[model samples]
Target chain A: MNITGLETLVFGVEDLAACRQYLLDYGLHAAADDPNRLLALDGSGVELYPADDASLPSAPNGCQLRLAVMGVADEATLQAIAEELGKDREVHRVDGRLQSVDDAGFAIAFQVSRRQPLPLIGEISNAPGSPIQRVPNQLGVVAGREAIQPRALSHLVYFVPDLAKAERFYVERLGFRVTDRFDGVGPFIQPAGSLEHHTHFLIGAPAFMHGVEHFTFHFGGPTEVIQNGSRFVKAGYQAFWGPGRHIFGSNWFWYFNSPFGCHVEMDADMDLHDNTWRPRLAPLGADASQAFLLRRRDNWMPGPGTPENGDYAN
Target chain B: MPKSPTVPNCHAQPLCHLSELGEGSARGFLPDEDGQDRIFIVCHEGRLHAWRNACPHLAGAPMAWKRDAYLSPDGRQVMCHAHGARFEPDSGLCVHGPCLGQRLESVALHISTSGQVSLADPHLTCSV
Candidate 1:
């Protein structure tokens, strides 16, 4: 399978107005013809519908994520996926896309990728011995840069009841490769066509917990992640986890709670792996997952409000 | 006489006007250092119920998709959006998701005749 990565997700939300505004405030552009559909820079985006909409698929576990639409490299790849999945289940062609469901019962679809190539460079560092450096007089960050847009739909995580079955379906059937694994937890996988560590992750849980865990978009880099996340917090969204770097993918992350029953994450600068790499397995833990954790605080200086203990004051 | 259970020191903390929380609405309060609420109140079916913001599934895990969004979208159930655990709004019993069979920690609430809603005992964290 020449699947590139996630393309779009459809969510059935009870409060469509709030969900729509939330996506727009999170920097997604409202589709010109359809304001309810929002897109990122690469054209990967989300479509929202009322939870009671009959056209939407039923989420077995009552999750808001109703369908996942993946992007493949070409029409042949899409057709191949359709034929493969069509063998044991119903695969329908609608709106030039092949729609089906994964082994774990989540609705899925495939389309020939229409992602627009990004023209900008990622955030650059001024390491002493590094070959790439910003031109002289170029500031590391500009004041009030344009609104940060997520570059692409990065990945999706699913909580499944049968880990082995889910992993086999993706690996053996869909040709997704295991990039790494968390001991007693799950595998991080990427489809054969792309290698930004993982485009999907599966966590094993009981049947009652079967649902989407989270989904994220790739930002320009860590600065964008922090800046956009802080802006989101200031806008009254609740922060869940992150504003930290992950050990496995080396991506800077900040996760926020969404009206959807799962988290939405901003991620950047992930490690890209190829066939030459081997998977690493480590115990699931805070120490193994994140490089470090930090909390948000108000800006301060050693002036009027400084305590008698000075900088040492808690 | 049997010995009574020792209790923590308690103090009254006024929260908000009863009219502030509209029927079928929720709000969070007492933000900690990290800006997470330590407790929340829900006005459901014309009665005010309070619970610690912590979800039973994870220690100290605050339960809101957004600030004061402690209930599901339809205003029927309390939801810990951390993992989609749904609890009964009036009873605080976990009805779905990871913490099945568990219950939210409830706090006693005192509503004055003048419509002041306060913590019955702010320091007395009680289990449901």
Candidate 2:
């Protein structure tokens, strides 16, 4: 039950070429072996197949996400998942990885994690009366120095018909712990092997509308999220929601509309949780969602006629 | 209604000349403060309306999905890009989406004979 993290996301798309181009614009490297599948620049996986691909599994709740592949800490975890899932439904192996469907009918796969520990490059900052993170004359931000790349697949959010059943399958069978919950909504569940607040967040939706709401990738920091999001917007993609800080995971997020029928997000600086941390429960609403939010726009400074300079005082 | 002190008194601070915006289009303005606070004015069908750019559902959620894309394709209502909530151009009332019955904070604007548009009460505050 010690699942590591999300390794890859398999999407069944109507337009292969458009999807491929979108992923390329999103900073994922296309695989030479499979043109439909892509790997994040850091090597996290994203595979896309035609909507009518026979190899794709049937979706239970009519979601576009055909399969969400996760990484296990070791062979023992894969064995445990196989054994636990085998008790009820049949288990299948594809490409040496064990695959099973959750109770809610979402396809999942397990394998050893391809995720590597990324080296940390701290984001520079300066404030009055505070020690500067960047030396004087050293610019903290360098737009377009390097293309913003997602380090790893951070998390995925799903809309489920029955919250209790989905929660039981992941928590009871897959050994995920709930980090937080909202009454009548769902829980933010983290895998046993990961310290992130949540790897999977389930939201209650109508029976026929169960599907992936969105999925996000981790960035180095808020600066990266902002810079990458700006670049993405400049590329002519639609900004769905964000460039704002969330109150739940405390991550800086920027979500955009994608061709995959769901939103794709770039997130950074999420909260970490452990066994000792007790999950908090609260009512969900707009005021409870974000502490601070920002819209990406041109920087505004005092214009030439501002009264600050007494140049245009009436 | 009386103006609140929290809202910046925009009377003295002119944003832009009306000629800078095309008729039936909108432009966003950032106050000289921290730049997070914003307002936008729309010249729709021969009338002008101005409101804070933040959506009612999410405080910092800007109405536009892109720069100055405040109207729906048909150019009828002010649309919130985050969730598809449509607001009336004149009233700023939410006509659809999760934040139904909510309204965008409308800012009082003064249009001078010289064709300049500026905030009427810059000192008035609206809750985030």
Candidate 3:
């Protein structure tokens, strides 16, 4: 059951208009729109539907319904997946795509190929003594005003109660491999074709609401996270957490509150690995998960040793 | 004993001792002159600062819900618990979360040797 890449992300939003506008403000291009549904594209497509819309599949709060399309080297590959999946679950054909529900209740969709290249910003580095010295400059001078474009849908996270069962289902049945693990905590599983840390993450917990934790896209660098994050703040959007670096993927991130009861993150320079890479298993602790946590600082004042007194000259 | 008017003017008096506000905590006070809502002040680093309690994001009242406002674990950032937006305490600039690079409104404060806290807006103080 090998999956290739993320095909589409489905969300149940309260206000279609507001959600649509939020995505547009975040720089996603609206390619298709109707009264009940909207398909937004950002180098890739994101499907949005009303919370009570019956035509679309339903996911619990904090759970995400992911469509992992298979990268078939040939037509025979698609036929193989359909044949294998059809043996156990009721596979439905819709809009020339193969759909089925996995054991974990996530609606899975398989297709030949639907992903397109995203307009990613070029790599940039800061010179010595620059304010953004350690961080990469993806957003450049576009902070606090324009929306920074998202490069690609990077990853999706899900919280599940039973990690063992979920792991078995994805690995044994769907051909996902455990790229890494948090000791007894959970496994970071990736599809055969994906080079990311994990395209699909299954966290362990109790019987809880299943939904998307957060979805992310690759930005050019840390500067983009700050620039785009400031832009969203000025636009009256609530920021959740971040513009911080995470230890897991080692990507600089900024998370924004979305209408979908989850967060949308802007990330960049995520570590990639191949089969030769050995997975590290560590306990899920805050110190082990994040390299550092920065608190908000007063940007209005100079440093403690600055010559100018605490007064600012207008 | 009868309670004073629901709206007590803090400006009529010079400075009030507000002990309920802990270090790095903030509370709203009635307007001093114009009846506008002003914020009371305290910061983690012992430096006093004040500003309107309203969060620019969604015009939401920040710290309205107690236990939702505080400095992050590191004590260098101000964290809004509702959405996890972290602001740099000194600069008021949001370095992480949704409001990156945007700053909170900074209000000037003067702390006396007797622990009396006074609001000192340069514009209002100059005219006086």
Candidate 4:
């Protein structure tokens, strides 16, 4: 399976206007011809449909990821997937795309990658013994700036009632590998085509909670995550988690509450893993979570009798 | 500059002497009587810097694993044991981790001419 990465995600939302605005506020570019489709800065994006639309297929077992479409390296890979999937599960070719359903009931699609190489301006930083990222006049950061756009869809997380069965289907059938595991929790699985730490993370959860936990987009660096997160906060969006680094993938993250009943995250600087790397199992705890956590600051005032009294929250 | 005695009738209090900490060591300082608020002073590359002991990620939980052991194995950066976030020595800017653009709340400090390091202002507090 030469699955490169996430190509697009189809969302069945309740409110069209609100979801469109939410994607825009999150720094995604919506198509002018079809407002229902939202594009990331990289041109790949998400498509939205009405929740009760009959055209949509039923969810496998109450999952938010209505249809997860992935890009393949070439048509040969697509044909290969179609042939392999056709053996037992009924595979359909619709609009030049192969569609099938995994054992867990999540819809899957594969196509020759429409992904393009988008050139983005990189962000820089200054650290001890490292070259200065910004010159004297060129400031690295500013207060209350414009929204930061996301580069591409990084990954998605799913809550599954049967962890063992879900892991087996992805690994044995779809050619995904277990990059890491959380004891009694789940596994971080990556496809054979990409070197990203994990393209999909499966978490063990109750059947009632079986749905998409959250999905994330990659940004330039930590600066983008904080700046974008602050802008989202200022816009009155609730923050779910983050502004911290994860110990497993080593990415800077910030998660925000969405109207879709799931979290949306902006992440940067995730570690790249190869076959040479050995997967380690760690018990998930606060100590095993993020390296350091930051509080959401809108305006912080000092206590009485401080040096100077003003707002330092940004 | 000549050495001056500790000023009386003010909130500023001496934290420790510069010689007390090595080039890569840290100590936690409790500001209020409640003992819930903590500040850690670290010696990074022979310079003194301090930050709130709480990580910005985990609801302001203490960043250290054990008492005052904040440095990574290389002893170059201050690491939060809860999530493995690392911050710079002087600027307290998180170079990599969850709180990338966010900085540690820095407590103003004044080193007296007599080598006494004291809080520049005791009234300063990080709001939750």
Candidate achieving the largest lDDT = 1
Q: What is the DockQ of each candidate?
A: 0.36, 0.08, 0.04, 0.02
Interface RMSD of each: 9.0, 8.4, 13.3, 15.3
Query: In model 2, what is chain B's TM-score?
Result: 0.77
lDDT of all the models against the reference?
0.86, 0.77, 0.60, 0.75
Docking class of 4: incorrect
Q: For model 2, how does the per-residue alpha-carbon lDDT over A151-231 read when each residue is reduced to its tens digit?
A: 788899988888899999999999999999887899999999999988999998776447777888888789888888878
Query: Each model's TM-score?
Result: 0.92, 0.70, 0.64, 0.67
Alpha-carbon RMSD, each predicted model: 4.7, 7.5, 12.8, 16.1
Off by over 4 Å in 4: A131-137, A298-314, B1-128
Identify the candidate with maximal TM-score: 1
Instruction: Judge candidate 1 against the unseen true structure and give its global Cα lDDT, from 0 to 1.
Output: 0.86
lDDT of candidate 1 over B71-110, digit per residue (tens): 8887899999888889998899999888889999888888
lDDT of 2 at A243: 81
Worst 10 residues of 4 chain B by lDDT: B1-10
lDDT of 2 at A201: 94
Residue pairs with clashing backbones, model 2: B6-B125, B7-B123, B7-B124, B7-B125, B8-B122, B8-B123, B9-B122, B9-B123, B10-B122
Q: List the lowest-lDDT window of 10 residues for candidate 2 chain A.
A: A305-314
Q: Considering chain A alone, what is the TM-score of candidate 2?
A: 0.91
